[model samples]
Target: MHVPDGFINAPVSAVAGVVAAGAVAVSLRGARKELGGASRSAASGGERTAPLAGLVAAFIFAVQMLNFPVGAGTSGHLLGGALAAILVGPYTGVLCISVVLLMQGILFADGGLTALGVNITVMGVVTTVVAYVLFRGLTGILPRTRRSATVSAFIAALVSVPAAACAFTLIYAVGGTTDIPIGKVLTAMVGVHVLIGIGEAVITALTVGAVIAVRPDLVHGARSLAVPLKLRIDGELVDAPVAAPAPVAARSTRTVWSVGLVTAFVLAGFVSFYASASPDGLEKVAADKGIDAKAEEHAAADSPLADYGVRDVTDTRLSGGLAGVIGVGATVAVGSGVFWVVRRRRQDEPADARVTETV
Candidate 1:
């Protein structure tokens, strides 16, 4: 959930800012390894991974626009932590959600400027960390099949939403600006979020399964599950003969990237118009429990894209559609840029090490 300004006291918000900053810094370092590929020979994997990471970010942003109804005047959207962490790696997943949150806060005014740290800490860091841990643990114990990976993705996603809700409750218990009782807020937050988690699980499972079916190689979480051929020699199983490396085909990510970008465009530009207008899980809980009593106005509320609408666009459909498109474009561009920079840094580190050795 995007915490607005004034929901948490200034001191607590500042502390959250520091925590968010530190988390982001750590993720940046970890992403180098994740995106750079596990082996030096596959340094080119960065070439394949970087663009896909950007597309994932854009897709998350687009899907978030389509708020599906949960129940009782509450709706929920894809948090993208599970989806991203499963598709990419956890480090990159954190950055993906952080990018989406930053874009929403600064461009759409969906989240507050002062509360950016809180939103990032809860939605990006907490969800990504929890989902990745559970996904890894489940996949470890389950069969190493694509189906198992997909199932793990589902369960991880289901748990991550409630985990984030609980995290927020704890944060509010310590820093909430309102007089609401902690118990009431905790109960309401966790109860409704459980429903939201189901929606998250379904969406995550479907998306992860689709990707696994198409290009399992691209799914970071499924990589370890990929099985190699084996042979029975002398009544004992042994590793199969290693095939010589074939001539490298001119691999192109254009087709997959195009398809993903088009899908995001359709979801945000067309389908979002039909999404439920009800308050999301966090919003509903806050409204009901008086947790939003001290919520302040977003700094960018007067911006053109504030509230997901274009300024001076009288047609609600057109205004929202344009804003959504813009959001997708902005997210893709920024995400790609950031990922590319990280990838480049990864590429450079080896060279710097070599130079040091020479010296």
Candidate 2:
């Protein structure tokens, strides 16, 4: 849920801001190893990881625009934390959601500026951390097959949504500006969010399954879990020997990247047009429960892309499509830059160590 300003008092919001900043800083450092392929294979390298991470961020932003209905006059969108974490890693997943939230807040004016920290804490950090933990736990107990991994992804995503909703409830209980009963708010938030979680689970499972099927090596969570290919040796199955590393420049992920970018474009530019117009779970609950009574205006309300429609573009479809495309482009560009830098820093570490040794 995108928390707006005034929902949390200034003091609590500031505290949340500090927490968010610290979380982001830690994630930045943690993402270097994840994106650099250090944990998977030293020979595999991470040149493709940077751009893939960027695409993941852009894809998440695009899918988030397609809000599907979850019954009872309420709609819910992909929170993307679970999906990103499953596809990438937990650290990179946090960065992905953070980038999406940042883009939405600044460009689309969807989330309030002052409440950025609250949204990141509840939506990004909580969902990613909870989903990753659950996914790992389930995978550890279940069969170590692709099917099992996909099932784990589904369960992880399903639990993560309500977990985040509960986190919001706890935060609001402590710092809510409204006088609504905390118990009622908690029940309503969790109830509607449970339904929303189903949608999230389906989306996450399908996406993770698809990625695992095509390129299991690219999926961070499934990389080490996938069973190696078997060879029939004298009518007996034997594990295939490890293949030699591909040339550094030969391991291009251009095909997957192109396909993913096109899918994101289609989803945001075309599919989003038919998305349910009803308020999302959080918005519906807020309006019905009066939690939004003291909601403050978004600081970026006057931005050219406010409300997901391009400024001065009267045609609804064209305006919204343009805005969505712009958002995807911006997110991909910014995310790619950040991840590329991280990857480079990781690559430089060994050389720096060598230089220090020589000195």
Clashes per model (N, Cα, C within 3 A): 0, 0
For model 2, residues 278-329, the per-residue Cα lDDT tens digits are 9999899999999999999889999999999999999999998988899999
Per-candidate alpha-carbon RMSD to the true structure: 2.6, 3.3
Candidate 2 collision pairs: none
Q: TM-score for all predictions?
A: 0.95, 0.92
Task: Give, for candidate 2, the lowest lDDT window spanning 10 residues.
Answer: 37-46
* lDDT string, candidate 1, 1-359, tens digits: 77888899998889999999999999998788777732442522455677799999999999999999988999999998999988888999999999999999999999889888999899999999999999999999998899999999999999999999998998888899998989898899889888989999999999999988987777888877866788999999998876764433335467778899999999999899999999998999989988888889999998889999999999999999999999999999999999989877776787656345336
lDDT of 1: 0.88
Q: Give me candidate 1's TM-score against the actual structure.
A: 0.95
Q: After superposition, how far is residue 114 of candidate 1 from its true place, in Å?
A: 0.6
Candidate lDDT values, in order: 0.88, 0.88
lDDT of 1 at 248: 31
Please give the lDDT score at residue 161 for candidate 2. Answer: 98
